[model samples]
Target chain A: MPILSVKDLQVTFDVRSAGSWPWTPPRKLHAVGGLSFDLEPGQTVGLVGESGSGKSTVARALVGTVPASGGQILFEGQDLAAMSPQERRRHRKDVQMVFQDPLAALNPRMTVGDIVAEPLVTHHPETSRAEVKKRVGDIMERVGLLPNLVNRYPHEFSGGQCQRIGIARALVMKPKLLICDEPVSALDVSVQAQVVNLLRDLQRDMGLSMIFIAHDLSVVKHISDRIVVMYLGRIMESGPAREVTLRPRHPYTQALISSVPIPDPVLEKARPRPILEGELPSPLSPPSGCVFRTRCPKAKPDCAEPKDRIQREGEVQVACPYQEVKDALAV
Target chain B: MKLASGDAKLLDETAQLASIRGRSLWADARGRFLRNRAALLGLIVLVLVAIFALFGGYFAKYEPDYVDFSLMGANAYRGVPSFESGHYFGVDFDGRDLFARTVQGTGISMLVGVVGALVAVVVGTLYGATAGYIGGRVDNIMMRTVDILMSIPFMFVLILMLVIFGRSMFMLFLGIGLISWLDMSRIARGQTLSIKNKEFVEAAVATGVRPFTIILRHVVPNLLGIVIVYSTLLVPQMIIFESFISYLGLGIQEPQTSLGALINQGAEQMNNGTLWMLAFPLFFFLVTLFAFFFVGDGLRDALDPKDR
Candidate 1:
């Protein structure tokens, strides 16, 4: 059974009253539009897209960080939208989020032990203070942090340790699923790999499921069981991470994979130059048919109508009008 | 079995967080704040001022309220009002001990200032936090109320309160406190609004912590610097306000005197051309204000996150 399911999710923000410089009338920016996905137990699903793809919004909405405009988020068996404020609080323990920025994620005034232990203290108010301190120390050790450093502030820790702190914060809840929003995007490349490996190890050991969101397809390809590609608030393609990375179906996906710089000089020079047509259109009023059509190299007349959803079996889903080409590319 | 697994997992998680606690923003701010000599000295002066208010008048030899018609306008107290005679500050119009009264009055001025500042902090924090956190209609309403209060003649409001309740120290403090908190609320609201949307706050919410706890724990703690700087800077201003009211003859009226009332009384005896009568208390008041300002400005500099 899928551990979590999100169906037809939509998030809209009213950007009314034109901006000061060249003000425009109130237009709604549809952030997350009709997105659906299911995460299996002990699986990592990478939600990949650029800045305005609404990947972060989906992550936030799943954890109830931001309220969903219209959607049903089912975790285990319960629907989050139907839960009361109090009920949501209880459910929050099952799904925790590891934020993007490590430095700003923590409470600046709190001790490292206190920041990690805060969730337990809040949810389990009956626990004794001494027990709380001990539990905090234990979690620190599990994250490979020395117990002696429990009292140290976040500033004393390096970027990698800070991400570890963030990860520990999520893990301390003993959650079934973790939502990591670009967790290692800020770290150096080498440190990013280390953190990614640590996360994979922790996920394996703890049996923790995750919804990893990031713009870097290369990193996600390594860690994710499945990858979902998004553009302008709509899913462009999705399937096994290996399948999507190795044989990209959509033109957009091919462009993205081709953009990754090859370390080998010969391969780098010989790689196909799949140039993107234009800058990704504003997600606010994205082009009609397929949201990626404006940039799709093989966009047909039918591609503008988004209702013409394209699908090919035994491979990732695609929304291009040139389904045959995409299917050919997949093989 | 489930419990043990979850517990073990929790243990691992908690340990990681323990390493985080030793390096937070508040600890750094507190360390930097403690090193500020001006704030520390201001704190010392504020405490000493409180002590003087509590047990200071006991040093006087006789009742300061004694009504001796024979000594009316004597320009001195207990003994004749004379320079170099150790009745140092001389006397008031009623020949009361000016030095004793001034010392005794320090308590009232400090009390009024503190009470006023406290009211301001409470009201201002609530107003500012509410206005800042919840934008749109509610924020607009609260801020507009503040604006209306600001536009009105504050002195008129004080005068109205005093006219209705008279010059009792309680009413005076209450009235002054009510007026002073408006600025604090505005400052607090502005700060709360800015910090409300910060990433840390969103992180707190994402963790499933209640809203109120977030406001108190995260939001308020960040505002400590603003509160401290504003409160310290406010003392001298509050003292001056009380003094000005006293100077206007509407504050801390008779036996229960204030620095302002005392200064006014000293000014009355200035017709005798004796400088010591007015100079001493006025100088004390000025120096106290100066110290508070130095401390307040220093604390502001040290606690400022932007400081290089």
Candidate 2:
């Protein structure tokens, strides 16, 4: 059985208007609209999407940071959505998250020692301070932060160091699953590589399951075992990483993969760019049938059929009905 | 190549650490603050004033309220500034020692100011933090109530309370503190609004830290810089407000004299050529205000995170 399974998860935000009128009804914005996926133990799943795609929302919901509007998030066959606050707190020991902006994610007032040990203090209160210190020092050293800098504040560290601190904080809890929400997006390109490499090393060493969310397909490609492509608030394509990136079945996924620049100039020039067109429609009123249909080059009249159904061809899941036909035509 | 560079980087980091030393945020803030002459001067003056308020009575030759009829004799007691015998700052109309009274009055003024400001700090911080953290509809309602309180003519209400309650120590503290918190709460609320959404607070929540603990530990600790600066400024204002009420004969009455009451008495006796009576009290009052202003200004510079 999968270690984690999100079944038809939904997250809706209420956009309340400012008015003097007392009877104004709040407008509902469906940020995450009925998305589902699964994570196997010790495997990394990259959730690829752009801003407002509800990729981050999914990460937030799974980590128990954001409340789900509706759905069942089963961790070892137990429903996360139905758990009480105390039960949810106990569940957090098995799961952890590393947020995007490293500096912003750390308390400026706290020392490196305090920031990393905070989770242990919160979740495992009976653990002695000396034990916490030893663990925190070990984890910090593991993440390439000198244990001597434990007394230093977050502002004293560089961006890369801060991210390492963030990583160390997540890993110190010894969680089974680590959800990194665009962990490298806010970093410099050179720094991004180091952090990604560190993550890959930790995941390998720890045998940890991970859900890495990022808009950069290339960044996620190196670390993720499988890829789940999202457009707006729904998954467009999902399968093994190489297959999804190399032989993308969905038009949106193909466009996204084609956009990643190949380092070899000759091949990069030779390959045709599957450039997508049009703005992503507002999630308030997404395009009928397919969320990606508005920007999809292969969008047909059948694409407006009100509900696009996911069809599995072997291992890969494609949301479009004519995906097989399209795949054949492309070949 | 990676291993060589990694070793070189480690050496570079060690060198950097050697140069930097271990400087704490508080130490850095103090260093920056000391560079500001005005703030430093204010700090010095404020410290001296606090000492005087605390230990000024030890130097008093006579009780502040003691009336020496023998010294009054024929001049109706008002005496010019002299260092003869025990009359340090001359004498008042009732033969009370001006220097002793001025020194002792610091106690009441300091008490009123410090206590009033403390009350404001406690109330404002709690109200604002709760409102800002538990936002949405709760925020709207709490802030609206604050707005209503702010809109009212606060001085009129203060005066009414003084009139009804008759200037007891409790009323003086309550009247000033209650009105003063209006501004403090607004400042605190604004700070909390900006801080509550910071990624660290989100990180705290993600780490499964309880909401109350997050607010108390993370949110409130970060707010200390602003709160300390604001509270220091409030003390002087509360002192001034107390003096103003007392000046109007509704504050510290009779045997319980404040700097304001002393100044009022001095102002009345100025025409009689007993200028020493007025000068000493006015001097003390002005010095106290200046000390507080300087200290408050210094604190603002010192506690500012931007300085670091």
Candidate 3:
């Protein structure tokens, strides 16, 4: 069974209308509208999207940071939405999240050891202090931090080191599933590779399932077993990572793959790229039918009509009907 | 055994590295505070003033209320800070020992300042943190209430409380404390609004920490630096407020005596040329207030995270 199965998950926020009276009703912003995905044990799924694509919202919903307004979040065959408060707390230990801003994710007032040990202490109150220390130390070492530096504060460390500390804190609980929301996007280009490699190594060693959320497709492709492309709160394409990057079926996915610059200057200049036009439509009034239709290069009149079914082309689940699997690398 | 030796050497090296690089936020702040010469002087003055308030009474030859009829007569000029008879600060118009009265005034003023600030910190922090953390309508209502309270004339309400409850220390503390927290609550709420949205608080929530625990552990500790700086500043404000009320004869009552009341009495007899009474108490009061301001300024600089 999949470790986590999120079926038709939705998250909506109530925002006050601009220039409205205090008593005026609020508008509904559908941040994550009907997102569904499954994570098998030990497999990593990369959730790639633009800035406002609701990738972070999905990660937060899974970790229970933000409440899911609708649908079921099934973890180990148990629906998390239906669970009691006590049961939800019990399930919290199994799913942990690493946030985007590393330094901001750590309590400035707390020592590194205390920050990492917090999950263990909260979930297993019966565990002794010594045991908590040992576990925190082990996790710190596993995340490539010196075990003796646990007494240090978050500000004392560099951004890359802080990210490792954040990772250690998330993994200290021995959680089955970890959600990383744009984990390395905030780091320097040189340091980003180190963190990505560390995460991949940790996942291999622990047999951990992960949902890696990022706007950068190259980084996501490096670590994800499968890739789910989202735009304006809906998934446009999802398939095996290699296939999704190379043989992108949806126009939106094709645009995204084209935007990632190749290392070789010659190939990068020669590649034919279709740049997406215009800003993302506000989630408060997202485009009808496929949310990506407004930005899709292959947008048709039919794209505006509501289509509930996601068509399957082999292992790929694509929302767009018009786009064929053209050779993405063809010069 | 060889592996154990290697591990021990590694541990030693890490310890040395830690000493060089692992200064905690508090330790760093402490170093900054120590480096500040004015703050050190302020601290010393505050400590000395506190010591005098606690033990200066023991050195006085006469009680605070003792009436020396000899000094009240034609020999009143003898009350001018004579080395003999142990009247080091001379005498008040009533022939009471100025030294003893000043000591008593210091104690009461400091008490009022500390107790009042304590109440403000506790009540304001909890009220503000709850309002800010819960947010939305609750935050709106709570903060508006504070705004409404702040709009009212603070001294008018304090005087009304004094009139109704009759001048007692408890009522004075309650009056000052209740009003003072309005500003503190506003500060705490503003801080909480910013802190609640920080990723660490969310991380705590994601780690299965209860909301209240997150407030207490994560939110409150982070607030300590600002709260402490504000509280230090609050102490002098409380002291000044109490002194003003006492000057108006609505605080501390006679015989009990605060610095303000003593200063009021001294001002009344200033025409008699018994300036020692006013000089002695005013000196202590001014010193104490300046000391508190210096310390507060130093703490603000030391604890400011932006500086780090």
Give TM per candidate.
0.91, 0.92, 0.95
Say which candidate scores most in lDDT: 3
Worst 10 residues of 3 chain A by lDDT: A322-331
Which tens-of-lDDT digit does each residue in B1-308 have in candidate 2?
Answer: 99999999999988777433345666677787798788788778777877886788777788888998876743334355566657688888778887788877777888888888888888888788878887888989999999999999877888888798776878877788778787887888889999988878877777788888988889888887788889888888888888888888888878878888888888887777777777877777777778777777877877776666
- Candidate 2 lDDT by residue in tens digits, A62-129: 98878998989999899988898778988887888998899999888788888999999998899998
Which candidate number has the best TM-score?
3
lDDT of candidate 3 over B1-308, digit per residue (tens): 99999999998887787644467889899999989999989999999999999999999999999989887754247888987978899988888888999999999999999887888888888888888998988889989999898899979988998999898988898888878788888888889989999999999888889888888999888887888899889998999999999999999977889999989888887787778878999999999999999999999999998998
- The residue pairs found clashing in candidate 3 are none
The regions of model 1 sitting more than 4 angstroms off are A18-26, A323-331, B1-55, B67-70, B76-86
Error of 2 at B258 (Å): 1.2
Local distance difference test, candidate 1: 0.79
Clash-forming residue pairs, model 2 = none
User: Residue by residue across A144-173, what tens digits does model 3's lDDT show?
Assistant: 998888888899999999999999999998
Ranking by DockQ: 3, 2, 1
The DockQ-based CAPRI class assigned to model 3 is medium
Worst 10 residues of 2 chain A by lDDT: A322-331
CAPRI verdict (incorrect, acceptable, medium, high) for model 1: acceptable
